[model samples]
Target: MNDEIGRRLREAAEAHQPDRDRMLARVHRGMAGTAVPRRSSGIARSWPKVVLAGSAAAGILAVAGLAVAGSVQTTPAHPDSETTLTVPSPSETPATHSPGTTGGTPPPAPGHPNRTTTARPPAGTPTPAAPAGRRVSEGPLSAQGAIDPHSTVYWAQATLTLDVAEPLTAFTVEVRVTQNGGVQSTGQWQTGPAGDFTVTAQESDGAVVYRWELKPGRTVPAARHTFAVQYNHTAGARNADADGYRVQATASDGIHTVQGGFTPAG
Candidate 1:
């Protein structure tokens, strides 16, 4: 029994010897001031991985927020699919007209004929009347004049006196002589007189005709004969009844005809 007990005790001491040695080595290392390595726990080993995963998630969230903000800034506030925009052409503008004028007619285009515009006359305007013909003389001859007849054995002579207030440029005279209740002769004369007398006798319409014309600046003073004429008989012989001789004379100033007559005593 004692021998067996000793063997068991020895075995137990052998087992405890390794533990003691390990404890002594730790104590020595502490005294020498050397670092001791520690065994890591499961939570400590996985801590770095957890931190990386959380950082990645935060980065993803930040990127997504930046994208959303950019989209909001660029997009239209009131976007609609049916909206439309238009631009005008240069030729579509309107034209302007002048003032104080009715928009009657537009100007003609280039390379085309120009159009004429007529103005309208005012209302209630009257047209002019034509001049009259056959006016009477307003002269001194109309107030005073005479024709006298005289007889010779074979011829008859007559004298004419005309008084005028204005200048005369032309004149005509017609005379008829009668004796013994019968027509003897008729005469007409036309001449240009310049302080002189022109006597002429001819036959027309079965009677004698005479005419005369006065020059420029031929005027009569008040109550004076400025024109005179003496006509000689050239038609034929005179009648025996000298007391029965009569003379009719007509004178004109182109616009009027005046008449006077007288009988002569032998």
Candidate 2:
């Protein structure tokens, strides 16, 4: 039986001829079918279309990512139009307007002034009255007369100023105050030495005549001299308009004589 089986196996092996090329082709097809699936005919023929579709999908995804990034970069969180506030400095502020000030400039402080003012005496205070008439000049002597402002309502003084241009060998000054209402000589004086002059005051010819004569041998140098005659008057402002003075002097040049009247005063 073993011999018969061996002969039958040998006969069967010899009868089936070994086709090596067909067997190799069969093995390659089996390996392709099991390890890697065989593509369909339509898939193999449209491979370019499949690859194109995949590339188009990747481009769309890249474009979408770029668009998202561009939106994030371009879009602003806040609006373009913004509000700005401006504050004024203290110096730029406008000044308040005031009366008597021009162009908005403030006026000088109170009790302060840009210009000076002439001070004047208060009301009821006495002011010296200026001479009413022109000065009297004769030869080397000139005389001006005015009423003393220091006089009151009941008393007054007549003043005489003498400008002597040369030394006087003889000099005599007389002030006559007319008795406007009630006038009487109270006293008399001179700017020269009292001992060098002889003063005599008396009422004569409806007036109080005050005379000052240089004493004998007494010299009066070239200078200015003042002579005043004080008197009592009525209980009101005295009318010195009628009052007059006379100055006579004998100098080296010649005899000088000047006469003038005082201004009215109280």
Candidate 3:
């Protein structure tokens, strides 16, 4: 029996040898085809993770950018609630004074060492009082006079006698001459002493006018005062065809006034 079994086993082994070699060859070929692409497939599978990491990094960068922008846009808080800064415009700002002294007392001149500075008087201030003298009586002034050298020539002279009831410190005299219904000349004189005289002559309205201011001064007592006046024309004579010339005189002692006049011979 052992002989028979042994022979049978040997025959079977010999018959299956070719099939086994063929099967082994097919398995090796499949394994070679699958092994070549394994590393590349693994790398391809990891690409999603790389992309996700890149997206996450970008998200972090965006969040950081937003935070920086928020910080830049925020306003600084002030410590004091009531305090605020404001800038003044050109029109609203007050003008600065120049680098010099303004109105008040002026500086003394360089050469005037002893000069005194005087303050300006207030508005509507009264004038200073006059010198020491008693108030004179308010009596009318008296005058008696006629122009002298009564000729038909171009020039003439006259004497006037004035009287005042009270003495005066200052006096004023005015003389007016007229001819042919028109004013020919006017003269004014003022003096503080006695024996002050003034003479004025002019031609107007086709006639010559002469005026004189007699002694106007304080030297005249409360009695009579005498003075002379004259008139002349350089270009023309008195109206030979008209009536005599007219003369008018006025005198004032600041408190009293008198007026008189006489025509000279034509």
Which candidate has the top score in TM-score?
Answer: 2
List candidate 2 segments past 4 Å from native: 1-135
Compose the digit string of candidate 3's lDDT tens values, residues 211-261.
333444423446765544344332234432232222223334344544455
Give me the runs in candidate 1 sitting further than 4 Å from their true place. Answer: 1-138, 142-150, 177-200, 215-223, 226-254
RMSD of each predicted structure: 39.2, 29.2, 31.2
lDDT of 1 by residue, 1-266 (tens): 44444445445433332234554455555545643333234334544565566556656655555454444433335755685676666577544333333334432212212211112223442221111222223443552223433443223435444445544444434443422322333332212232432334333344333333343345323343322222333233434222111111222444444454433423
Q: Of the candidates numbered 2 and 3, which has the greater TM-score value?
A: 2
**Roughly what TM-score does model 3 have, to 2 decimal places?**
0.29
Task: Estimate candidate 1's alpha-carbon lDDT, on a 0 to 1 scale.
Answer: 0.37
C-alpha lDDT of residue 14 in model 1: 37
Instruction: List clashing residue pairs in candidate 2.
Output: none
lDDT measured at residue 19 in model 2 versus the true structure, 0 to 100 = 48
C-alpha positional error of residue 236 in candidate 3 after TM-score superposition, expressed in Å: 9.4
Write down the TM-score for model 2.
0.48
What ranking of all candidate models by lDDT puts the best one first? 2, 3, 1
At residue 159, candidate 1 shows an lDDT of: 45
TM-score, candidate 1, is 0.29
Model 2 agreement with the true structure over 158-202: per-residue lDDT tens digits:
778888887899987777788777676566666777778766665
* TM-score per candidate: 0.29, 0.48, 0.29
